[model samples]
Target chain A: MNDKVAQTVKTKGITRRFLIIFSVAFCLLLASASTHYFIVERSERIERETRELLNIRLGKAAIERDMQDVISDLTFLARHNETSGIFLPDNLDARQALAQQFRVFSEQKGRYHQIRVLDETGQEIVRVNYNNGEPIATSETLLQNKSDRYYFTETWATEGRNTYISPFDLNIEHGEIEIPEVPMVRFGTLMFDENGNKRGVLLLNYLGSTVIEDFREATANIADHAMLLNSDGYWLSNVEKDREWGFMFGRNDTLAEHFPDAWQRINARDTGQFSNRDGLFSFTTVYPISSSQGNLGDGLGSLPADTSYYWKAVSHLPPQSFSASLGEFLRRNMPLYSTMFIFLAASSFIVALTRFHHRQAVSEVETERSFRELLERRVDERTDELKTAQVEKDLVVQHLIQAEKMTAIGTMASGIGHEINNPLYAILGLAEAIRDDDSREQARGHAGKILSYTKDIAAIVRNLTGYARPFSGTEHKPIDINEVIHKAVSMVKRSLYDDRIEFRTDLGGLPGFSAHSEEIHQVFFNIIRNGVQSIEDDGSLMITSRYDGEKIVINVKDDGKGIAPEDHSKVFDPFFTTKDPDQGEGMGLYVVHQIIQKYKGSISLESVVGKGTTCVIEFPILPSVKKGNP
Target chain B: MMKQKILVVDDEESVRETIRLQLKSTGHEIIEAEDGKQAILLLGQSNSHGVSVIICDVRMPNINGIEAVSFFRRDHPSIPVIVLTGYPDIKLAAEFVEKGIFDYVVKPVEKERLIAKVEKAAIQSAVMNIVD
Candidate 1:
């Protein structure tokens, strides 16, 4: 029963169910979050790199287009009638006029640093420097020889219609850069005679600041940096101004030195993108700076070039640029958003569920505790009810035993009356003898006899009154079984002789058990009378008593016409008797059984048909009933 | 005058002594017996003071007053038998008379009444003995 209750407790355990829900929800949330993160990470990275690549392409293309436009301008100057000096044919006055025309052209295009013409002997012909949008023609003595200059020498190697682009450099005057360093790139084209003979070369120095300004304009909306690298892997453009163009001042820091991994990938591909912790670098080669949108070597300036147009443009985007698509994904996808929302809702629910279950578990404990207390109280109440009922039954049986005693005495009334009247006869007769006819001595003796006989009658009356005494007291008294037995025997002595049944008793010395003397005596009387009456003629009735350590044992054995074996068990039942109605009222053994049961005792009969019957009664010694010792 | 021998029968010695003392004053010779069977045995002995009357108690250990009354009526019909019993019911008295007993008296009768009945019964028995 207790195990069943425990099983119910487990089945209703709110805490266990809550834990199961919580664990499953947590694992599901963890799994969903990890998968979402993986997909979003890859997508966001690709979007960021594409954006950076587009910005780099735009910035790089702008720089290349500017160079192409500058080449067109130089080509126009080289082909012009006045500035090319084709009409002069080595005329000194025309040459001076051409110089003046070149200065006019330099002033028109303000982005140029210098414009100059050189003769076949590498002598300075005409030169003009446009300083910050102001054209200033250098005098004859200020013009330097162009013989050792690579731009001039490299132009001599060109055998066909071509242009020589100089390596990007800072402008120097008198072997030192002027007060502020001026970055420049020169675009030079060889002059041709009308007969296809080479004349002097035309060179224009372009301001490098136009490239930086154009890159800035193109990448203005982009939140990342762009880089331009020359073919030799030199840094031509970078976010850090100091790190750009390291080769110009002989610092020689290559793109590979700063971003080796990005340089290797960009170096191998014409257009590609890579992302790292510093963010994305997407690059494309924007060489030749031409309007043809093809290789510059394919045009009329294909031959006699010392170097090709060789710069690539790269955009550097930080890691955050890649997060735009991820943020957009968060905004647009309702299912993913709902998943997140559900996770949040489920988390809240779990917390609430835990709290709710905790409260439920606490209440369950309280309920179980109260239930146990109620059960205990009910059990105690039932025990008390049983005790009260037992006490009431004891009282009823006691009254019945007393009633049975009276009934037994009633049955013996005639014999008892005779017994009393016999004593009375002796008393009255002796008294009259003493008074009237006797001698003085005889009278005295008769008086003594009369006193004794009257006393016997008094004793017999005492026994009857004791048996019929209304049991008033509920408190138990200690009574000797021996004394109760003897008194019971005396009450039935006359009846025994009337039936010619011999009565024998062996009463052992016994301790006092708590009981009503009247009830115990009545029990003995009922049992002994039943024994005496069972006999037809000349039967002997034997009663014995003893103590068996923890119990008092009493046996009433009779050698009479015994009972049938089947009737033996029922003999103690109320109104169960084999004798005729007038000879026996069957309540005798029943009352005896009841009185013994009041003491928590047991009774059994051993009887055989025609042999004999023996009734054994036993009582457990109560705790208060120790052996009566000295 | 020859003394009339009387049979005294009772289980209680006190009752027997009471009867003896009552009869001693009357000068009748009393033969004491504890029960009716003893009384009948003594009657059978027939001493020179032959018993003229028998007084038997009804409730006795060996043989009761009822059995002894029938015995004398059969075997010694000449002797008059009187029943001296402690408990007396009308039916039992009728039974004794039907069995031809001379008289029945309950216990504790007056001393004079008891002696008169015994003397009357003895005289009646002696008168019958002459005719028999």
Candidate 2:
């Protein structure tokens, strides 16, 4: 359960890291893609505006070229000698010949509305009209006498062989505006007589609609955006045809009114391009007559440079057309961008997954390592506990051995008291006798007895003290096993005698071994005491000790009330005893067994109920202790 | 006021000899027995009938003072038994007193005190003889 929670936390951490990495990567892709998109969009806008400017430039060039052509044609007619022939005294058919020549010129050009020759007084001498693709001669009576027209007067007034061009406007045949607006430009040049005297002017009413049509053709691709505006800011040709020639139609609508800011900038330059929020504007000025002056025939010096007369060819692109349309932009680049996006997403996901897996692997290894460490620590702790338990067990065993020794001393207390008291009694009695005796001889004998009795008490006390010594160290010393057995027997001999139980020791000569004499004594003491206690009455106990080269063996046999077969196994166990509770604590044999085992000895018992019991004990002679032993 | 014949029962010969020496001035006959068993065997003899008091030591081999005293009380009720032992145990003294023994004495007893106890036990033995 804890592992599941930890796993969830780890997964969440990895997911958070993955999200961070993927989001950064995705944001980077978006940044670069948008940068590329904007760069492309800006570049496309520049390219489109440049093309528009080029279109207007080309339109302006075309209009200037056509105006030059018209001036050249007028110069050609004016410089011809046909008019000079009409002024000759004997040349009567020169006027008729010039009229026919002009009719033929008008018929072939089809762009001319009328071709006429007027005298210097501004009276028309001859005229030819292009009647909508047909040529006709105007009779003498129909020709106007004095011309108030600017093209005719201006040509006659100019010095040298210069030309005159009138402002483009609608043509009026008789002092009324033409119904079907014939937008016109008049080109005129003065004619010279044979003597180099100017006699009349050659006037051609050029159709203005042809120039507008040429503009439309030149900018046909952007015909809707293309515009032709006169210097007065009136439209000559516009996408809305009704807006054209607004000055002539007396309409206030014009480029200046509709786009004042654009017109201000457009009219300030001869050629430029600019944009506003509404749209892109590209325009160039066309100076027709002044530009055409240099291209006239040799004899025609041309007109004065008219800087004021110019037409602006403007190309406007509305915001929708000028800027990129979102739908179109997506149509063109959706595949690439979407593919790039998908690739970015896939790669980022893969990278994130790889990173997540790497982290998981690292974390798993860390977890495994930590778990192993935890297990090792637990093992170390368990080992420490076991070691502590072992030490505690050693302490407890020592305590138990001491406690058993104390119990053994307690069990011998009565016997030891009797043993001590018997001698005490003897000494007391002998002293009393010596004090009461009258004869020196009897007193001496009693004194000797008292000394002997004191000596006996001392010897008994010595044995009791030796057996009852508290357990101290574990240091071993070479000891006679027989002597240890004697001392152990002495501890309980008095008790056994009182109980009418006889004990005998058949000790053979034995090699010495290193051992604690106290421990050895306790072993025999416990066994002997147990044997003595088991006998109800008149029991005999015999102990035998011998060394058989490699080992020391001792056997204790008793003709007492024997232990039952079932109890024989448990007799050596702690707290297992047949003695009454006050007589024993049941630890005697158990302590003996423990001490024997500690010295690498073995003990075994054989018993039969109501018959006898025998206990045999054996200890291997250690090499270290057997050295120098006889 | 005839000289009393006292039976001294103990495992140690010195104690019996000392009691004999202590009673010499009083002129009591100091008969000696090693233990309760020896004392019983001596009493069984025809020549040992004049024993008026028995001083027996407890914790002896074969027959202890308690068992011999019980036997004496049963078989020779006129004979007073004094318990003499080295162990000064109140419980054992109380048990012997309840058993109608004449007196209980711990060993290493003072000479005067023992003589006094022995004289008292002899008087009790005379009284018991008269009652029997």
Candidate 3:
């Protein structure tokens, strides 16, 4: 049964230790993996947002460049000498030359729907049409009057050389929406004669699709999510063609209708980028006729440059596009993270199992060995019981020593009583003198004596009570042996005088140690009192204390009757005293021996018969005691 | 009656001083000693220095009151000696009384009792002198 118990005892604790180690290892792995995963996810999101912003910036630049190109073409044609000559009456050759110039421009650019020159009356003198990438010049008979056209009338009304950029809209022909759905912007500039007189208007019908196509090309990477919207929040270019030109179709497919929150932000900003629950939106305002380019009037145009004509180029990334997918992130990293975790778990398990098996084997061997020694162990237990009894006996002896201490205090009561009474007697006599001696000066002197005597009595009582109380619970405080010796002297000094034994001390600077002051006092009290009693007549009992580098050495020498060498060994024995039976109980030196041994100190007596005796005691300074004067 | 001298012997200076103060107005000359040794030394002077009564404490350094009293009983047997002790043991008091000491007074003695004892001891000494 004992063998079984021993074998399993260590395994239970071993398993629990392994479990604690495994739990800690798993928690650490989890923490590191979570940190790595979040870092990867955040960085991916930032990279995607950066790419989308760049796309929006480049698309806006492309759209603005295209609009500037159309303006440049219109200015070039209007500045041509042939355009001035064509405005003169009966200048057919000039008209044909200007028509040929416009045809070549339309054919080369392939972005003009029509290029026309209209007189002040708004009649076209020369017109060129871009017939599906083919440029054709119309004869004077086929050229129609465009006086009712807003582009011709608006351009002719300009005072000086100025370009007029019209808003983007679908083309209307003969008061009906044009077929094939052409998106147009008419750029017109008034033509001037050689004398700087207003002559006619040069108009260009620009193909708006080219600008949209250029925007798409510039943002091809994010084209599917890119959008171009007019200032009115109408989409000019959308992924769904049906959603584009909602203003023309009277459809509620505008950006404002689709994404009101994104439109609100994009409408208010000229350029910015932000992210929300709808994901990343990077946008910029593309001014088709920016202040610098739209006013070509050279300080003579009626219309100032328009700041309101703008398109919003936006690159959007939906939540799905920009948000790092947890599944994908997990797929990329889970295998490694899990493998690391499992590898550690398995390694720890193997280590734990190996140790567990090794311990179990050792435990079995231990169990067998213990079984073989069972009889010896029983004998050991019996010996242990004897030792326990010995300890109990030592405890009883300690109690007896305490009782003996009380008895010693009882013997000390007479000396202490004398100590207190001497001062008390002085106080009583002085008080009586103060009452009877009517002299004021004499009364003052007596009162002073009474005060001092009362103080002396208080001191004596304090010392007596302190010495009488047995040390309880063995609580030790740092004590200076010199101070304790002084206290011990105070308790028995009065009695020493009675025996005419002069008590003298040469206490040196010794290090302090932790001990019950009462215990140390009792030790010294017994030693000194023994020396005093040994004196049959007037003699000097001198105590010299000094620290000899490593130990405290105290020598108590008495010029009294000494001890015989033959009985030196038995002097420390309990109930061993040379005094009469009535004089002492004889446990004094024995208790002193016990206390000295408890402090790891040693005491020895050196004496010769008829000569004085010297008690030399040495206490080793414990490592914990602070060195220096008490 | 000639002016008599009173000797007070005690280990404590305060006790000797108090006794001196108590006997100040009595017209008897006062002498003080710190201990029994000093008292015996002073009394060992010529003709015992006319000290009529000795007030001595039992506990004293060098020679105690008891030993001093024994010396006086053998040498200056006419001078009266009073033993004042803090330890008031009946056996010790009886022993001193048998040893022919004039009085045994415990410490913290009443003022009247101590003064009466000293006066009575002083009168006994003067009567002995007159008888001589």
Candidate 4:
């Protein structure tokens, strides 16, 4: 009982060990794998951010170089002696020389599209137009603007002589795109004599196409979405051409307008990059904005405050830029991945094995239970079979007893009939003889013979009726052994006589026994009748009774054809017979043996083939106890 | 019919004597034997009287009526046998009669019926056209 329990606990211990090992291995693999993923992700992110920031600064520097070139060209024009000679009291020769000098300056330096000199009244003092490939100074008649132009008014409003750079846009002539769509910006600065005079503004129109074109060329080789937006988040240049310069065209579709959430983070941080599921966006305020470009002060120095009015450059890298392949990471850490996989697989296999064994154990238990039930059912069936067999055996025994009684009666019936029949015949024949006899002597003699034959029939009838009647005597009585033998012989003598056999009874001095006399008589009768039937003809039966020591011995012997050796063993068995079915029921010796046994007597036979048979019964002088009628 | 000769066979002496006495009043001759074997032997003798009819009992120690009749059938084909029995075993009696026995009579027999049966058997024997 406890053995199975202990085995189950042992099995549980082995499985639990595997379970704990699998759980710890699985958790450790998961933690390490995730940690490696985060580290790789963060490193890739920082590398990509630094590359984007460098590209943004590159784009801003291009724009600033174009602005510095315009300012240097304007300052060189202002310091020329031909331009200051105008303040030396109008010498015609000096004025003509200045015109010639301006023409030559435009021919030599062709980056400027237009150059002019204006006084405080916004008059063009001297102008030169670079037409085609050469510059030509305009006559005095073509210097038309007095003061309405913004570059002229914005410069004259400055308290000190200071330089101003105009916003970059597509050049428009009379509210229409200029021929060939020239992108331009105007540079204006106040001009004054050596000490303190407030002179007019000198301005130049610079070509802005080179800077925007350079930004586009730099971004063309890379897959990153690069855009350049100004201080107000207006797109200056975008990889998508439609998004650029929207604020300049009054559309104002800026980066802040499209992605407000990203703009909030971008507005708070400078020179930073972040990643989201959609894409990678890196931005930098390369030239930081200080105050609004609409306001200006007296200071004209190139201070930090002056440089603050500048544009921002932004680059959009797509989602692929931020995440490196986890596959590549796994390839580098092949042993680690393989270990985790093997652990998981082994755990799964163990779990499956445990489940299979659990099912097997359950099925085995069920099989045992079913087998026990079957055994119980078989035991019940066997018990029932035994009971039924016992009942059948009881019925067989009952039938055997009834058959034995009928057999005894049948064996005696024919002999009894012959006994009665012979006498009847003698009586009928003698009665006729008597009636016909006239002499008294002869008639009297026939009548006497008839009376004796009648007596013979009466004796036979008495014996038959006595035997047929249900016996009421069961008590043991003191019986003369010789008397019982004589009575037994009387019943069977007629049949013996009919067969031409002689039955002689010799009665010796025999003591009486306490027994059922009729039963003992039956035993004698059975042997004598059997003796008579065994003879074919001229046989003799002899019955003798005597006392020997403590036993009373009765012998009935037949001088007839003897029982065969093969049949001797079965002669006393019930239903064993050599006689015809009509003649006997064949239970004679078996019943005789049983009756002798009831008195505690034993009967034995001795015989020789073709000689004779002898049946000897020896019973005690007294029975141990009286038996009821069977 | 030449005054028919009758043979009576019985195992018992009293029955034979009674049958002899019974046939004495008749003018016909009577012959007797103790059993069927003696009756058959008497018929087989050269000096034996001509037995036209035989009355024999079935229950006898040696050569009972059935054997005597069945044996005499081939030897004395002209003679007819009548079966008489003390026990009324009609099936056996009838079986013998079917094999050309003259008649069957049960014992404790009526004398009148016995005499009539004997006369009929005598006449039957005389008239039988058996080749012998």
Candidate 5:
């Protein structure tokens, strides 16, 4: 007896151990799923941010290309003697001619700041500025004396083959004396004579703020920071210049320190890109400056691409910047972690509850063992209780289905009503006018007839309203099936007809029958319309109806495109339209199925992809009730 | 006898045809234009002379029916204009009425109702002609 008790105790302990282990495993699984969800969400956000940064970088690169193109055009035009003649010693004829040319160039480009010509020796010859009549300055000093300047040295050394773009400066002046102060970013290109002799340099200065302004205007909504930097780590343009570039430049640190191997590669190869430790990615492209003048060289002597234009290097910053505020980063990620933590807590609670329940069951089993017959009787009672529970569950399911149907019907009714009301207003207005007109006898007679017809219109409206909300188990009535079909087709077609999809009706030989006409009409309309949409290209839909002894058979078939076999069964499921979620609620076929079932009809579908789909509906015909002569 | 000219304005050719067919039995001359822009050009050219009434469908692509009616009232006050609309909102109806629209008709238009409205508009126009 002592050994039997020991065995029972050991069995109970083993059961308890199993319950605890199972509960812990289940809780761990739940926690793992929650963690995975958090990780996936975080990764998606990071990816989106990375893409945005890439787009911004590409946009900036395009803008820079355009600026270079403009500069090149100015350089080419300036090489002509007729173009440079304006810069010659204050000759009225030449100055006026140059001013006219400048006006045309400015009008065409919409943003050229000034055009200036410099002698081969680097002395300013003549200039036209866009500062609303600012005074023009000439270099009295010898051009040879200032050969060290980038504009002069590059032009002279490259033998008029290079163009120079100057950095942003505040006090640059251009054109006539009366104009306002022009804060300019200047560019200069050399001009060579036909004999290859260095002639002069053509300089164009544009508003620096305007260049940055255009970029900012184009990307006003982008949230990421954008900055322009030189190979020497000089800040070119930044929205918050002092905060971002100021801090970096003040430290005199190589970009390699901040960007790591990526910056090192960019400097080594003149172009490189990499993602930061935090997964912030960056792309950098560098174009070599052929001369100290910041001039891009032309395709002379194996210079990378055409350097005759200013070489530009572009780079996109990574999505996760080390410079991001710790507070903001934490805030953005808190939701994911919080969700995971909540899931963990819930799972733990469930584990605890399950452990308690298992202990209770063990204790109950021990107590029940003392009354074996009583326990068997209790089990029988429990089985009966389970049957009652199942019945209740079925009732709940029925109620849920009804509620869902009502909700769907309500939504569809609102959409249809809104669509129908527009036409109804026109009918109402025309009818009212007829009633008010007391003109010629013939006209008045016509008006009288129209008034009666409008009453028929009101009746149609009433029918539509009733049809939109048919009660469950409503008795089927004798209805003209052909008219219902025509009405439904016309209703849907009138609203959606466009250049893309032409509605073609092959509706032939539809017989009049007795059934719930409105319901059947909705079913036919929904199915036919769906078929029409399935054929995206210009296609034809053939709808045919025939009487098959005791039943009416209707077939809707499309010829443009067909549904995949896998999706065929899913088409009739609720919220399962192949159309975009925004365009369709996917409930059309589901509603049609419900209506057909309600009217004791059966619907079947057959489809072949790239060929077409056909839907056949069969409905029982009801006997018509004749109205007594009234 | 001169054919009674009827001006029809709708964005849709099919909708215009639906009305045209219903009015064909009346033996009136039917003139159709797609939108207010085309209707204005036709009216300006006097291509639809002796036009008994103008029937315009609202919610057209460019200028709507109510706006077209207002334009007609301003340019040709003697011409009675009817506004046809699918939307029967009270606010829109009130706005059309204020613009001196001869009538407003709704869509899925009852064929007979539309005919009667057109006939009444024609008679009113005739009475105005007699008064003038």
Candidate 6:
């Protein structure tokens, strides 16, 4: 199983593929995560803006409801003439009672700037201020312009109902004191008899700053500007109020400029939401407050039957701002993520390298084993081949040795034949010469006497040639020593007769020996012949045969020049003849020695330089043989 | 004087006949012994008849010619002896020559040479008789 795993690892490029897959997957995951974070940040900004818009619109609606309630209360007091006839009553008690009621009504409305009652002729009959000061004569100026004032006109136009005024300023004076002008949001109403006859008018004013305060409180968590604007493209309230409405209107304008477009769309119809050029997202919800009450002023006549009380709740969250924070967070954590990735990649690389190394090691071991097996087989084959060749070489060498021996024997045979031929020729010539002699009548008898000697000579020659010839067969016989000696001397005599060398034979009776007779004859002839040729002048060759208990000994002693001392031992060595090459083939003594050894005999030589040389040979007699045996 | 008689002993008859013919032609009476035994017997007979010299081959059958000469010296030392031979046997012949024999010759005998040696032997025999 482990081996299989190793094979799989080797074939699959597993580590490389794994690293490639891991890196690609990790990069994809990182990219997707980054995209998701970006989308979420953008969506969070959008959602936060939307939530701020809804909150600001809810706050503006609450303020519009409060204004409607104040208008209705003032219209009820004017129609009853309880609060409107405060300044028209002649009695001090009645005037005091109406003024007290107006002051109580103004105090009950929290956003009101002032409350006042005017006569049918547009004189300011009574006034109530939130600061609680006595009315001055200049407060009557508001009544003089009652036809232009939203409070008087709205009350006269709307027969007996409350009316909301457009946002404006109010002039109020107390006795000998002028009250500061207050920008107001006002409402008015007129009193009427039961028969619908016109009565005195009622007016109520609210502080415009109060609307911006409510919007700011509602959208505080939204992270953008907030404002409210009316239908005439005027800001009812802006959180940043110091800037002109124009500065908030264009692409390069302030946060308040986005309010008018938002408000106009709201006032033209129902609620609407938009993103403006000043980087504000605004939602305007319109609550249509009833302006039928005369408490709302003259501008109420321009209001739709359902008056658009526009509350623009605008909030902006910038894309650039959220992305900056997200980028900072990523930068802070980048080193940690990168370090983790590097560690994982390095471990993967090390594992791949180790697996590669293991595969190489295994392959090397397998290759080495195969190589060793091949080497062993080759060595075995070579050794077998060498042994076969060695055996063949030995066979060739044996044949070569046999061939050399045959060549040597052939040379010796030719030499021996030549040596013996000379002697036989001499003997034949001598015998013929004796036979041809005719000088004396007795010479014929002498010729007849030599016939037997010539026959002996011929017999000796035949025996020599037969011995000198290579063996044709194997045979052994008892041969007389006397006869072999006589033949040897006769042969030597025939050859050396011209040298005047004399040969003497002493044949002591001896038991005959069993041997190859022709071979022994050749041995004797070769030795005696060599002795006869050694002499330079007249000399004697003495040959003797005797018996030594179990052996027959033949000695050939020569008075010729003796052998050299140095040459004595080597004389029997093959090719070591002392004679001249033309007369001797150096094989005579060597063959003699070999034949003697074959007969279980021995030959020895004793010599003196001027005296002689003697060669003695002894052959063991066979106990079972007689002299005449074949 | 009767022709000077010469005795020739040789075991070889051819050698003996050759020497006899050669000496006979030279006006010497030739006597012969076929072997050493015959020559010894003949030498004893011829000594009484006044034989002047004896010529003999040294090698013979039964008794050698040199031994016959020794016998002759003992029995009749004054007779002159001449040795003849078919082959050279100088050492054996030199013995007889030293013993005051007539002379020695090797055969095939030269006729003039034999006659000369015979004349010298005859003179020596006469001087020896006078000395006796």
Best by the TM-score measure? 2
lDDT of 1 by residue, B1-132 (tens): 357888887877878877887777788888888876787787767472478898888877767778878888998898888888765567679999999988888876778888889989989999999998
| Candidate 5 stretches greater than 4 Å from native | A1-42, A45-49, A79-92, A103-113, A132-148, A159-161, A167-185, A194-196, A217-224, A243-262, A265-273, A277-281, A286-630, B1-132
> What would the per-residue lDDT of candidate 5 be over residues B71-98, giving only the tens digit for each residue?
9989877778887666544666788889
Go through the candidates in order and give each one's DockQ: 0.38, 0.33, 0.39, 0.25, 0.06, 0.03
Runs of candidate 3 exceeding 4 Å displacement: A1-391, A438-444, A498-506, A548-550, A626-629, B1-3, B24-26, B44-49
Which stretches in model 4 have alpha-carbon errors above 4 Å? Answer: A1-148, A152-163, A172-176, A188-204, A221-302, A306-379, A382-386, A393-630, B1-39, B46-64, B70-90, B93-132
User: What lDDT is reached at residue B123 by model 6?
Assistant: 80
For model 6, what TM-score does chain A reach? 0.48
Which clashing pairs does model 3 show? none
Local error of candidate 5 at residue B46 (angstroms):
99
**Which candidate number would show the highest lDDT if scored against the true structure?**
2
lDDT of 3 by residue, A1-630 (tens): 998885676566566667776788888887887787678778876776777888888998898788778777777788765335787789898999888988888999999999998888888899999989789999889988989877877777765665677878888887776878788888888878777778888889998888889999999989899998888888888888888788887887777787789889988888888887887888988887663365444443444556667889998888886455677877888889889978988877777778877877898789988986996898899899989997887686677567767777777666766877888988888888778878899789878877887887787777767777756786788889998888777666766447556789998998887788877888888888888888888788899999987789999999888998887998889988889775678888998888888889999999988888999988888766756775
TM-score of chain A of 3: 0.54
Error of 3 at B31 (Å): 2.9
- Model 1: per-residue Cα lDDT over A1-630, one tens digit each: 999996776555644565666567767766776577668777766666677777877887788778777877777777774244533546766666767887788778778888888877677777888866678777867767798888898876665646677776677777876547677788787787777777777888888778767876786656337677788787666667787667767886887887788788888887887777666778887665343223444345544323256677777766675557566665666577577657766765666567666777898899999999999999899989989988898777767776777777777776787788887978887777667854899788877887888888999888778778878777988788888888888778864325367778888878888888887887878877777777766778899999878888999999877888778778888888887786567888899888787789998888877778888989788767775821
Per-residue lDDT tens digits for candidate 4, residues A1-630, read 899996886577656666776677778777888898778766866666776777766765666555555566666676554246664546656655766777777777666677887766777877788785578888877777759878788777755544666766677878786867677767777778766676667777776666677665655544247777766787777767777677657887987787777776777776777766557777776442133221223244543446545666678876664444566677777787787679686975586567656766887799989999998999899889988996786466434544654566665554565556666767776777777767889888888888888887887788766754543546777777687777777767644324467778787776557776766777777788788878876878888877766787778889889999889989889878888786577777877777777678899998888999998889875444223222
Which sections of candidate 1 miss by over 4 Å?
A: A1-368, A383-391, A431-445, A471-480, A497-499, A507-516, A547-552, A567-585, A590-603, A618-630, B1-9, B17-33, B39-56, B64-84, B87-132
How big is the positional error of residue A532 in model 6, measured in Å on the Cα after superposition?
39
Error of 6 at A68 (Å): 4.2
Task: Please give the range of 10 consecutive residues that has the lowest summed lDDT in model 5 chain A.
Answer: A285-294
How good is the docking of model 6, by CAPRI class?
Answer: incorrect
If scored against the real structure, what TM-score would every candidate get? 0.53, 0.63, 0.48, 0.45, 0.36, 0.42
Worst 10 residues of 6 chain A by lDDT: A414-423
Question: Candidate 2, residues A337-363: lDDT per residue as tens digits?
Answer: 888878877777677778888888998
Candidate that beats the other on lDDT, 1 or 3, i.e. the better one: 3
